[model samples]
Structures are given as structure tokens and as C-alpha cells.
Target chain A: MQHTISVLVKNEAGALSRMTNLFSARGYNIESLTVSTTLDTKYARATIVVTHCDDSVIEQILKQLHKLIPVIKVCDLTPENSTTLELVFIKVDSKNEVGELLKIAEAFGVKVIDVSPKTYTLQAVCNEKQLKSLVELLRPIGIKDIVRSGAVSINVKSE
Target chain B: MTNKIITKELTGSQVFLECLKNEGVDTIFGYPGGVILGIYEAFYHEKKIKHYLVRHEQAAIHAAEGYARVTGKCGVAIVTSGPGATNTITGIANAYLDGHPLVVFTGQVSASLIGNDAFQEADIVGITRSCSKHNYLVKDIKDLARVIKEAFYIANTGKKGPVVIDLAKNVLDAKIEFEYPKEVDLEGYNPTYKGNPKQISKALQLLCNAKRPAIISGGGVLSSEASEELTELAKLLNVPVATTLMGIGTYPMNDQMALGMLGMHGNYWANYAISNCDVLFSIGTRFNDRITGPSKEFAKNAQIIHIDIDPCSISKNVTANIPIVGDAKIVLQAMLEEFKAKNYEINKENKREWFEQIEEWKKQRVIPEIQSEKLHVHTVLEQIYEYTKEYEPIVATEVGQHQMWTAQAFNFTKPRKLLTSGGLGTMGFGFPAAMGACLADKNRLVLNIAGDGSIQMNIQELATCVEYNLPVKVMIMNNGYLGMVRQWQEKLFDRHYSETKISGPDFVKVAEAYGAKGIRIKKKEEIIPALKEAIEYQGPVFLDFIVEPFEMVYPWVLAGTPIDKVILSRKE
Candidate 1:
């Protein structure tokens, strides 16, 4: 099972490295991680989406995270009526592949954001699985560049 | 919101010293280095706190552990950055494993060059996080006082362990307002204090109904200073008491109700009693794998009741029928009160036969064999005990057969007199620990009994004793091998001694090189004379006794084997 956990932590140097090291040390597979500064100057929020772990194992990982000095709060937003998003940017061949890419992007509710002489940039805001499939489809059509903002999640209601 | 009287500006070192004074620290063990020069300068003029310059940072930490173990007080240690900090890792881990209260301070590179990999810049906090109960990397001068206070409080409180405070060099030099925090406001640091009343009542009821009840006390009781309450409860219930290695000093070893240590290398009688008891109450011990050998068959006839300060330890190793999470002192007091309320009667018939059986086992199995002219480990231990019997000296030992022999032969009638690295089984813990123990109670004699192999691990501590003019008598049982490991191989591995053979420089010469009195005892009759001469010396003394090899610690219960199947002695 996959778990998407959101953590609020103090913005300090080596904080990210410590979290990543913890996951590596425990042999936990982190499929996706996205971190950003919150509106508060003192705090940074990290949304981590991990896969192939049981609920109990995830709970123990969360408990260990809670023990970290900088971590203030941790919440598992999965199975809790939450909203999740993943943004992906891809540049495809505009000369010949633009029409086919646009058709596929339209099918997946993606938007064409930018165009160049030889390439076109496609923007996608969708679930992780959909984003992955869309990227795979655009890869064979001459993908010049690709960037992905790993999954971010929030619960439907207040904590 | 309120005006306050401004104090004079002070250097970081002065502020650090003031914080320690405010925390009521009387002594600290440390070695000065380039990074910690500021702290050293402050120490030169500090009159309130006495600082002992240990030979090595590693020894400093172990000495601190020794102080904590004997006094139930928070021991403090200071070391410089990089190598000095790294040297203290083993001692820190040992204290953490043994749950000793210790506060360690390490100097760091200047704040400006912290991340630039400057000279002597090791991330002490990052390296020690897993080993310490808590740790802090102080970057700002203003946070020093609160961090120091919190470090002491955390290290000395519930399930006590070592805490490290890594101070940046620039922070030590920066000026700041000094104000110690009266109380900590940590959100996730609450430790459970009161055991569940319902569980306590249930445990009491179980004890009331048990026909053969026993209490297995561990170091937790000693850490909590609950020995008095534990003895009262045991006597009120007429229960037999057994101690783990760490709990040796918690109860009077000579008490008839005491079954001695119980574990892989424990007394046969104690192991048998634990295996045969109807109800077993374990307090302040995490049932280590060595103690519960083959958990499936451990205490097969008993219902276990485990009481520990940490809730996670309850079911981590052995499953407990009744688990009580609280401070050992508080829980034991409540149990004593409940026992008083119930007016519990002693199960005289059950205890009578059990005690008789233990005595029988002791007479047949506990006695060591006198084979030939060669001096045995037990004989050496007996000689030491005989010599120190009148003075009631403090005995600290390194791990192995020598330690067990001392524990078995020496009659410790009082608490805090027998100090050893029990939980950590740390080698080289004896010499420095003995030194620290002597510092704590200077009026009494301090004896360090150690195996030759174990002694070599931290033998450098002899310099510390010599420097301080501490008269610590060290007896090294020299068998030219790792005696304990060889014994195990002989018993369990078809007598295949692989890497047990040990060869090294003359220990006496090594002691002499370190400017300490040295003596060697080869003849059987020279043991007492050598010990007396060494004891009479005004400074630290080392006695190396080249005892017989292949002399195994007997009445040994082979690992995974039952207590009843113990091998008493060699047939030859």
C-alpha cells in the first residue's frame, strides 16, 4: 500500500538530508517527495508519497519521524478524503508530433502551455498514475525535456 | 513585558561555566584540546566545579558513567571536537545501553566554518543522535543555558541515559545574556511516571494468589533508588529475589531470600529458581536475549509480570502477562502499600522447599574445583575478597569470568559497592570506572578486578589514576587468552579454540611505563602478599596474576540449554 504523509518541520539546514537518510537507513522506499516553505517563515511542509509498505510499518515510520527534533506535526492524508495533485512539464516535437501529443494531452486533460520552433511544452496537473502514463505516451513522440513536481496532498477537511 | 537587572557581559566559556554552576554540577571529567581551549580557560579559575583531566576522552565518558552508576547522579563529561568526540562514542553508547545518566559536552568548529569542513569539524550531534537519549547542536549563544539545563534534566530523568551537547567554538566565544530556563517546555518529552493503578492492583492480586512468587530486580531499581522499597515489598510477600548483572548492588547478596544473578553466565541456583517459580516479577529490566536464553523454555512454569519505565520495553523481547509502565520507585511503593493493605502471608511451605533446593544446588554446583598447583580464577577472586573483606572496599570489574567470579566470591552486603559494566558488558570499563568510583567515595578502598584481555581495552586509564594520585588496586587475571570466549568454545564448540589465544607486552612493564606501581604474582602464595603490598601503596597499583588457562567458569548453563542441565565441573 502507498502512503502520502504530510509533515510540518522547521526550516533548517540538513533537515532534508536527515529525513532522506532516515528513509535510506530504514530501507524504506520513497517513491516521491516534495518539500516547500509554508506561509509561515519558520516552518516548511514536506509531502512524501511512498509505496509498498503496510499500514503498521508506515505508522512506525511516522512515529520515528515524530521523534525528529525539527518535526512539529505529521499527518497521513491517504484514505482520509484528501485532494492530491502532481504537476508535470514536458516539451514535445512541435513540427510533426505536436498534433498527436495535443490529442493525447487533451484526452488526459493536459494543457499546452508553451510553443517553440521545434518543440511544444505540455503541462499536466493530475494524479500520480495519470501523470506517469502521460509522460510515457509523450516519451516516444520525441520528448525534448521533462520536469515533474512530485505528488502533493492535503486533507479535504481541517486537521 | 518587565524590566530586569542587566548582568555584565561574559565570554562563552564563562557563560558555559555559569550554566553548569546553576545546574549544580560539582564535578566533570574531560581532556583539554585546541577546540575546547575557551572552556579550559574558564576551568582554570572556576572554583565551584572540580574538573578531573582524564587521560583520554573515552575514559572520561566511562568515568562519568561510573560516577552516575554509583551515585545515581548525572555524570558530566567534556571533550574537544573530531577525534576527541569520536573517542567518546563507545562510552556514550555503553551508557545509553546501560541507561546511566550522563551529560556529555563536545566542542565544535567555529560557527563561521561549521559547514566548510574546517579542521576538527565533526558533526557530533549527527553522529551521536542514535546513541544519546537526546542531543543538541548549539549554534546561537543565547540557547546555551537552556540547552545545558535541558540536557541535564533529560539525562537524569526517566529511563536515564546519556545526552550530548555539541557547542560551536564561536558560540563558546560569543557574548550572550545568561538566564537558565526554570522548566522545559518540550511538547513530546513527557515520560510516564505513574503505573496504571488497575494493573498494579492486578499484579498485587496475582502475588496474593501465587504460591511461589519471586522478584527479578534489574538496574532500573538502582537507577530509581528504589532498593529500600523493593526489599520491603519482597519481604512483605516472602518472595525470593534474583538480580540481573546490573542489579547486583540493588539488594544484599548475602540475604537468604536472594538467589543471586540469573542469566547465561548466572548462578545455577538462581536460574533454577527462576525456571521453577510460579510467578515472576521483573522490575526495571529489559530481559536481554542473553538472560532469557531460548525464550521458549525460559521460566516455563512462571507467569511473568514486567515493570519498566519505558512502555516500549514491555513486549520488545519477552512477552509479559502483566505489564506495568511507570517509574520503578513509584510502582514498587504502590505495590508495597497494597501488600500492606492485603496483609499478605508468607507461603512458608513453598519457600522452605525452594530455599532448601537452592542451598543443595549451591553446595553441589557453586563450589569451584581445586585441581592443581596452578592458580584458578576463582581462587584469585577468593583471595581478593579475603583481603578486602575487613575494609568493605568498592570492587569494579571488567566483563568475563573474572567479573562473574568476583560477583560470586565477594559478599557485597551493601549497595553501590559493586560496580561493573553490566548492561553494556564493556571491556576496559573496570580501571576507569574504579577510578571514578574512588573519586565518589575517597574514604574507602577501590579495587579493580579485570581479565587480561578486557583490561587491555582501556588500560590507558591508569595514567588518569596516577595523575590524580588515586590509590586504586587493579588485579589482572592473566590467562593469555579471552577467557570467557575460550570457555564458551570449549563447552559448546568441541573444544576448538580459534582466536582466543592472546599475546602482548608485559602488563607490569606497561603499568611501569605509565608511571604506576606494578607487580606480578605467579606463585599461589604470592597472591595475598602482592594484593596487600599494592593496597598499601599510596598511588595506583597494578597486579598481573598469570593464572592457569582452560579453567572454565563452572556450573555453567550452556546457551539454549535448561538450568537443570548445567555442567558443574570437569570430570578429570
Candidate 2:
């Protein structure tokens, strides 16, 4: 099972290390983690995606995270109850399928952010499913490079 | 516009002592080094806080832990950087796991030199983060006083544990206007001390409905000063009471409802009650594997109601039907209030049946017997218990079989009387902790019951005890092996022994060299007189009792087995 946990921490040196230590120290598998300063510059929010964990373990990890002095809040986000987004940049060899790739990007409402003689770089920001589909659709076009911003979420019920 | 501003100036080291005073700290256990020289200089000028210079930084922390455990007050320790800071790691981990309140101040390299790997410098904050309840590395001089205040507050409140504050050398040298924060507002650290009304009601309902109820009180009860409440509740509800090793003194051992201890090497009756109970009321215990045996099988027939101060500990191991996150004393009081409000009373006849069953289990329980004419370990503990029974002495122990023997044989009738490494089970905790206990109260006798292997772990602390003139009587059960590990190897590993076989310097000679009284007893007949002599005239006395080398703690439950599946005797 996978869980997307949102953590709010004080903006300080080693704050991220303290939060990540809670996972690494316990051998919890963290699939993706994205951290950025919140609107309040004094605080930062980190969205951590963990895989291959059970409900009990996830619950404990949340509790341990709460114990960290730098951490202010921890929210376990679910797909139904929370809004989430992941942004990805995909570069495909467009010499062979320039028309096909552009058409596919237009269909998904993605922009061709960059284009070279042999490749086209497309940018998309959406839910994980739509992002995965875009990557799958472009695989036949020969992906030259792909980079993703890890999942970030906010609970619908709380600020 | 003539406006005059007043500023008070003081060095960071002076602020350190001032903040400690504000926290009501009267004593500190610490060792001085190059990086901590500034604090030592400030200490010389400020004589308000008495400092006990321990021989080793580790002993300083253990002594502080002992002091904290005895007084229910936060213990304070100070050590210099690098090796000095790392030396306290075991003691910090022990206190952290056992929920002892300790605040440790470690000197660090100047801020500029921290990352340069400067001489005698180590990242104390980074090193201690995982072991500490909370830690701070004070970079700015202005944050020094507030961080110290927060360290003490966090260390002593809620689910108490050790907190480390790493002070850079430059910060100690820098002068700042010191204003101690009256209160700390940590957004993430608010702890709920009161039980939820609904949860209390539910727990009370379970208690009223239970036909076979058992209360397992743990270290939380001791730490929270809830023994009276726990005892009253158990008696009021006609529930049999058992204690974890850490909870030894939480209830009177002589009480009819009391079952001495529960878990691996716990009393047979207590283990039986746990396995058969209709409702298991656990207070202040983490349900560690040693107590639960096999987590899945533990109290499978019972509804377990776990009340802990730390929310994370509630269901980390075993699931709790009713999880109450609150201080043990507060929660127990709430439950008692709810019971009275609802006019709930125990059905005497129904409870009588349960008591009778526990009695039956007690009758069938195996009490280890000394089959040899030679002196045995239990006999030594029994004699010590008999000698010290009148004084109600504070007992501390190093980890191993002697610790278990002391737990089994010694009578701890009140809370905070017994101090041992219950969680981390760190070796060499007993002697220094006993010194700390003695330091806290000079009137009461302090005893350190140690194994040959464990006593040697921090034997250097004997000098500290002698220097402080603390009357800590150390009784070493000379088993010549790490008795607990050897017992396991004997049972499961074909008795290969391996590195379990260990030797120690003659403790009597060692004590004499440290300018402490020394006594050696090789026969059972000499035990009582030696104990009396040592207890009567002792700055510090190290008594070596050479007992049976192969004695094992019985009623042993193998790892991952149910608590009920205890091996009754060696033959069994």
C-alpha cells in the first residue's frame, strides 16, 4: 500500500533530515518526497509518498513524525478526500513522430515547452493517473528524458 | 526625545547556570573538558548549583538518570564535546527508552568550526537526535536561554525523556541579554494530560462488566506518582494487580491482590492472569515484546485497555481496544471518578472466583530452589532483601540475571524505590545510578545490585562514589558470565557458551584501591554480617558475593512464544 503524508516543519537547517530520519531510521520505504517553503517563510511543507507499508506502520510513522520538534503537523492524504498533483517534463525524439507527439500533447492539454531539431519537451501538471497515461502514450514516440515533481497534496477538510 | 533603554549583559555560560536555576535545578552531574571550560569557569563564580564531577561522562549521565528516577525531577548532566558527548549515548538511550526525565548539556565546537571537523569536536545534536526526546543546537546567542528552558520543559513534561542541548563554544563565550522564556510554545509538542471523558466512560464500562479483570501497572504509574490511585482502583474493582519490571514499586508486593511482576521471568500467577483475563487494564506500559511475548497471542481472550502518556506508544506493538492517551495518574483518577459517578461496584462473588483461579495458579507456580550446598544467587538476593528490608532502601541494578534476581527477591513496596535499566537494559547502570540516588537523599540507604559482568562496565565510577562520599553499597553477584545471555545459550544454543564466559577484577580489591570499603562473601553464612557491616559503616562499600555461576532466571518464556508458555523450571 502507498500513503501520501503531508508534514509541516519549521524552516531550519537539518529540518528535512530530521523528518526523513524518522523514515530512514525505521527502514520505511519512501517512494517520493517533495519539500517547499510554505507561504509562511518560517515553515515548510513536505509531501512524502511511501510504498510497501501497512496501515499500522503508516500510523506509527505519522506519530513519530509528530514527535520531531521541527514538525508542526502531519496529515495522511487519501485520493478521494484530498487534492493532489504531480508535474512532469517529458522529452521525446520528435524527428520520427513530431506530428504524432504534438497531437498527443495537445489532446492531454500539455504544452510543448521546449523543442530541438530532434526532440520535443512537453510539460504537464495533473493527477498521477493522467501523468502516467501521458508517459505511456509518449513511450512509443521514444522518450529521450523524463523528470517528475513528486506528488504534493493538501487535505480537503483542513487548511 | 530622551529615552533610556536598559540592557542586562551576561555570557552564555552564565545564562546556562541562570536558566538551570530558573528550572529549579540544585545539582548537576557533569565532567569538564576544553570546549566546556567557559561553563566550568562560570560555575566557579556561581556556586548556587552544586556540580558532582563524575569520573566518566557516562557515569555522570547514569547518575543523573538515577537522580531523576528517584526524585521524579529532571536530571541534568553536562559533558564536553567529541568523545565526551558520545560517552553519554548509552545513558541517554537508556533514559529515553525508559521515559526518564533528563536534560543533558553538551559543549560543541565554535559554530564556524562545526563543519571543519575541528579538534575535539563532534556533531552532538545530530548524534543525539534519534535517542533524545528533543534536541537543540543553539547557533545564536539570543536563542541560548530559551532553548535551555525548552530543553528542560520538554524533558520533564508529558512523556518525559532525555533532552540534549548542544552549545557551541563561541555561544558560551558570546555575551547576550539573558531573559528566560516563562513558557515554551511548541506548535508540535502539546501533550494532553487529561483522559477523554468518553474513553474513561468506556473503560469504566468494561471494568464494571469484566468478570476476570487484571491491572498491569508499569513505569508510567511510578513516574506519575499514581501508585495510590492504581492501588485504590484495583482494590475498589476487586481486580488482581500485576506489575512490569519497571513497575515493581507501583503496588505493594504483600497485598493480596498483587502479583509481583508480569512477562518474561514474571511471576507465574501474573502471567496466568494475563492469559486468562476477561479485561486487561494496562497503565503506563508500552506493551514491549518482553511483556507481550508473541504480540498476536498476548491477551487474545481479553479486551486490553491501554493508557499511556505518549500517543505513539498506545498501539505500536499490541492493539488496544480502548486507547487512552493521558498521564497514568490523571486517567486513573478520571476512571475512578467515572466509576463512582455511575455507582459502579465490583460484584464480590464474581471477582472472588477470579481471585481463586489466580491463587490456584500461584499454588502451581515454581519457586526456584537452591539444590546445591554451595551458595546460590537467589540466596544472596534473599539475604540482601532481608537485611535491607527495614531501611526500605533505594535499589538500583545493572542489567543481567542479578537484576532479575533482585526484581524477584527484593521487596519494593513503594513507588520510585527500585531503579534499573528497564527499557534499554544497559549494562553498568547500577553503581552510578545508586550514587545518584544516594546524592538525592543522604538519609536513605542506596543499594546497587550488579552482576560480575555488568559491574565491570562502569567500574571506574567507584572513584566518583568515593570522591562524593556517597554511601552506595554495591553487591556484585559474581556469576563469571553474562548470566542472562548464557542462560539462553545454554537452553537454545547447545551450551556452547561462546563469549558469555567473562572474568572481573576482584571487586573487593578494586573498591579498596578507590578508597572505598571492600567486603567479600563466599559462603551463605557470611552474607548477613557482611551486608550489615557495609550498610552500617560505608562511605561506599563494594561487596562481592561469589554465588553459583550457572544460576538462571526461571519461568522463562522464549522469544516469540506466548507469555503463558513459560518454562517453569530447568527440567521443563
Candidate 3:
């Protein structure tokens, strides 16, 4: 199981290390993690995708996070209960299939950000499932480079 | 008194001292270095605060923890940057896990040298973030006073734990208008001291209905000073009380309702009761794995009511049917009051039947009486207890078999009488902690009951104790091995000891070198005289008791097993 967790913490030095240390020390797995300053630069919102933890373990992990002084808040955003988006940029070798690459990008609502005779850099903003599909479709053409923004999440209700 | 407002200017160092004084701190455990020179210089002119210079940074923090445990006040420790700050990590983590109220001040490199990795610079705040309950890095000189005040406030209040304040070298020298905050408001840290009324009602109802009710009191009961209420409540309901290692002094050992200790190395009768009880009312304990073996099988027949200050602790390891998140003192007091209001009293006749059943279980296995040629560890501990029983000594211990034996042998009737590293099980905590306890109250007898392996861990603290003239009796039970690990090897590993065998320096010479009295007893007959001589001495006394090498803690419970399935004797 995977859970998208949004943690708000004080923007202090080593806050990220402290959060990540808790996960590693407790043996929880972090699939992907992304952090950025919230509205107030004094605080940061860390969007982390934790995998292989059941609901109870996830709850316990969140409780442990709450014990840390720097952590202000922890929220678990399940797929059905929240909205999430991930931005990914994939550079595919488009030596001869430039037209096919553009068609695939258009179908997935992706933009062809950059292009050269040898490669096509495509960017896509989508949910986790759609992002996986886009990567699978581009793999045959050959993926030269790929980078993901992880996932930023918010609950449907203001909780 | 007239209302007069006088404004004064002071350096951050001066403000730091003033804030501690305002908090009624009379002593500090510390070490001096380059980054902390300003604070040290300020201390040179001070008369109100006494500073005990420790050998190592870790000892300073452990000493503070010992002081805090005895006095029920936040202990303060100060050390310098980089290595000095890093050395306190183990001690800080020990205090954090065991819930000690400690405030540690680590001198940081100047604000300019912070990120540049200049001489003696370390990200101390970053290093200690995971262990400390809360930490602060003072960037502005003006925030120093407020930070110090808040550090003390947070360290001592609401389920106390260690807090760290990283003082930049420049901030200590900077001049600032200082005004300490009278109060702190942290939105994220509002602890519920009062238990929910509805939950309390439901818990009482369950207890009244339960035919086989038992209580497992933990360290929280001691921390909150709720032992009196706990005792009263146990008596009123006729519920037998079993304590954890940390809960040694939370209930009087003389009480009939007392089932000494429970879990691994716990009493057979106590573990039996916990396993068979229908209603398990746990107070102030986290239900650690050691206490609740095989979480699923633990208290299988019981409906549990857990009362604790930390909400996360409830249903953490074991499920709690009724969870009341509140301070043990406040919550216990509320429960007692509610019990009184309801006037639902236990009939003595019915309670006697329950006691009779527990007594029948207790007689099932008798503690083996060994008539061995070598001095037994239990005999040595029993003599120490017998000699010091009248004095009502405050006992602190290093982690191992001796720790468990001391917990079983010593009789503690009140809270704060015994301090040990329970959660973290740090080996070197006893001696320095006893130094702290002695320093906290010179009149009371403080004993550091240790093992040969553990005493050597913080052996350097002997100098500090001798220098301060703190009469902390260090009783070392020398068994020539790491007894606990050896026990496990003998049981589960087919007796392949593998590095468990250990030796130590001549403790008598070591004590003499540190300018303290030393006594050695090889024969069982020498135990009483040696203990008496150590007690009568005016300074720190290090007593070495050479005991049987293979003596193990009995009634052991292996991990992942049922609590009731305990190995009663050496033969299994």
C-alpha cells in the first residue's frame, strides 16, 4: 500500500533530515519525497509518498512525526479522499519517430518542452496512475532521462 | 511593594544565568571549552549557581537526569561545540526515552561560522533534533533570554523530556536588552492533563464489573507523583498492582496488593495475574514489548483501560478498550474522586476470594535457596538493602542483571526513590546519575548499584564525585561477564558465549586513585561489614562484591513468547 503524506514542519535547518531519519529509523519506506516552503517561508510542506505501510503503521508513523517538535502537522492523503498531482519530464530518443512521439504526447495531454534531432523532452502533469501510463507508453521509443516532482497532495476537505 | 520598572542591559551570557536563576536552578552539570568560554567567564563572578565540571559530556547530561529524577525539577547541563555537543547524544537519547526533564545547553560556533564548517563547528541542533524533545538555535541575541525560559518551561512540564538549546558563540558575547517571557504558548504542544470524564466513568464501570482486575503501573505514575492515589485506588478496588522496572517505587513493596514487578525478569505470580486478568487497568506505561510479550497474546482475556499523558502511547503496542490521555496524577486523582462520588465499593469478602486465587498461584513455584560456596549476587543485594533500609536510600542502577536483581530485592515505598535507564537500557548511567542525585540533596543517601561492565563505562565520574564530596555509594556486583547477554546465550544460543566474557580494572585501586574510599568483599560473611563501612564513610564509597559468575535473573520471558510462559528456574 502507498500513502501520500503531507507534513507541515517548521522551516529550520535539518528539519528534512529529522523527518527522514524518523522514517528510516522506524523501518518505513519512502518511495518519493518532495518538499517546498509553504505560504509562510517560516514553515515547509513536505509531500512524501510512503509505500508498504498499512493503515495502522501509517497512523503510528504520523503519531511519531507529531512527537517531533519541528513537525507542525501530518496528513495522510489516500487516493479517493484527496487530490494529488505529479509533474514528470521525460527525455526520449526521437531519432526517427518524432511524429509518433508528438502524437503520444498530445494524447496524454503532455507538452513537448524541448526537441532535438536525437531526442524529445516531454513534460506531463498528471495523477500517479496517469504518470505511470505515460512512462510505459514512452519506454518503447527509449527513455534517455526522466525526472519526477513526486506528488503534492491536499485533502478534499480543509482538514 | 511598589510597582517599579527598571530597564537594564546585559550580555546574552548574563541573561542566560539570570533566566536559570529565575527558574530556581541552583546547580548545573557542565564542561568548559572554546565556544562556551563566555558563559564560563560569566560563571566566574556568579555565587548563586554551583557548576560541577564533569569528565565527559555524556556524564554531565546523565548527572543532570539523576538530579532531576530525585528532585522532580528540570536538570541543566552545558557543554561546548562539535565533539563536546555530540558526546551528549547518548545521554540525551537516554533521557528522552525514559522521560526525564533535562535542559541541555550546547555552545555552537559563531553565527558567521555555522554553515562554513569553521573550527569546532558542528550542526549540533541538527545532530540532536531526533533525540531531544525540542531544540533551539539562537540566531538573535535578544531571543536568548526567551529561549532559555522556554527551554526550562518545556523541559519540566507536561510529560517531561529533555530539551536542547544551541548557543552560538557570538550570541553569548552580544549585548542585548533582556526580558524573560513569563509564559510560553505553543499551539502544537497543548497536553491534556485532565482525563475525559466520560472515559473515566466507563473505566470505573468496567473495574466495578470485573471479577479479575489488575493494574500495571509504569514510570509515568512516578513522574506525575500519583503513587498515593494509585495506592488508594488499588486498595479501594482490591486490584493487585504490578509495576514495571521503571515503576519500582510507584507502589510500596510491603502492600499486599503489590505484585512486585511484571514482564521479562518479573515475578512469576505477577506475570500469571496479568495473563489471566479480565480487566487490565494500565497507568502511565507505554506497554513496551518487554512488558507485553507477543502483543496479540498479551492480556488476551482482558479489556484494557490505559491512562497516559501521551495520546500516541495508547494502543501503541497493545489495544486499549478505554483510553484516557492525561497526566497520571491528575487522571488518577480524577478517577479516585469519581470512584468516591459513585460510592461503588468492593466488598471485602469478594475481594478476599481474588486474593486467595493469586496466593495459590504464587505458591506454585518457590525461589530456589542456593547454598553455594561463592557469594551470590542476590545475597549481596539483600544485605545492601537490609543495611540501607533504615536510611531509605535513593538507588540508581546500570543496565544488566544487577539492575533487575536490584529492582526485585530493594524495597521502595515512594516515588523518585529509584532511577535507572529503563527504556534505552544504557550501560553507563548509574554512577554519574547518582552523583547528580547526591548533588541535588546532600543529606539523603544515594547509591549507584552497578555491575563491573557498567561501572567502567562512566568510571571517570568518580573524580567528579570525590571532588564535590558527594557521598554516592557505588556497589559493583562483579560477575566476570555481561550476565544478561550470557543468560540469553546459555538459553537460546547453546551456551556459545561469544565475547560476553569481560574483565575490569582493580576497582579498589580505581576508587583510591579517584580519592574515594573503596571496599572489596569476596566472602558472603564480609558483605554486611563492607556495606556498613561504605555507608559510614563521609565521601563516595566504591564497594566491589565478587559474586558467583553465572548467576542469572530468574523467571525470564523470552521475546515473542506469551507473558505467562516464563522460565521459572535454571533448569527450565
| Top-scoring candidate (DockQ) | 2
**Per-residue lDDT tens digits of candidate 1, residues B1-572?**
65987788888899999988888788899988888899999999989999999988989998988888778788899999999999999899989888999999999998888879888889888898777777888888988888888888889887899999999988888987777788876654667788898899889878767877778999888888888998888887778898888888688888888888878777777888788888999999998866787777778888889999876567656778999989999999988877677666655675677667777766655556666677888888887888888999989999998988887788776667888877678888888888888888888899999888988888888888888888889899998999999988886789899999988679889889999999999888998889889988898988999898878786677777665566667762
> In terms of TM-score, which candidate is stronger, 1 or 2?
2
TM-score of chain B of each: 0.95, 0.98, 0.97
Candidate 2: pairs in clash: none
The sequence of per-residue lDDT tens digits that candidate 3 reaches over residues B1-572 is: 76776678788899899899999999999999999999999999999999999999999999999999999999999999989999999999999899989999999998988899888888888788778888989978988887888788788777789999999988999987777788875645667799999999999988987888999999999889999999999988879999998888899988888998999888888999999999999999999898899999999999999999987798879989999999999988998999988777566665566778899888856475575688888888888899899999899999999999899889788889898999999999999999999988789999999999999899999999888899999999998999899989988999999999999999999999989999999998898888889888999999988888887788788988998998878877
- Local distance difference test values of all predictions, in order: 0.84, 0.90, 0.89
Tell me the chain A TM-score of model 1.
0.87
lDDT of 2 by residue, A27-124 (tens): 89988999999999999999999999898999899998987878899989998889898888988998897888888989999998988898888899
Highest-scoring model, lDDT: 2
Quick one: ranking by lDDT, best first? 2, 3, 1
* Candidate 3: tens digits of C-alpha lDDT, residues A1-159: 888888998897778988898888789899889999999999999999988877778878888787766788888877788999989999999886777778889999999888888888889999889988888888888999989989889888666
Q: Lowest-scoring 10 consecutive residues by lDDT in candidate 1 chain B?
A: B563-572
TM-score, candidate number 2: 0.98
- Give the lowest summed-lDDT range of ten residues in model 2 chain B: B364-373
> For candidate 3, what is the total of clashing residue pairs?
0
Better of 1 and 3 by lDDT: 3
Find the candidate with the highest TM-score and give its number: 2
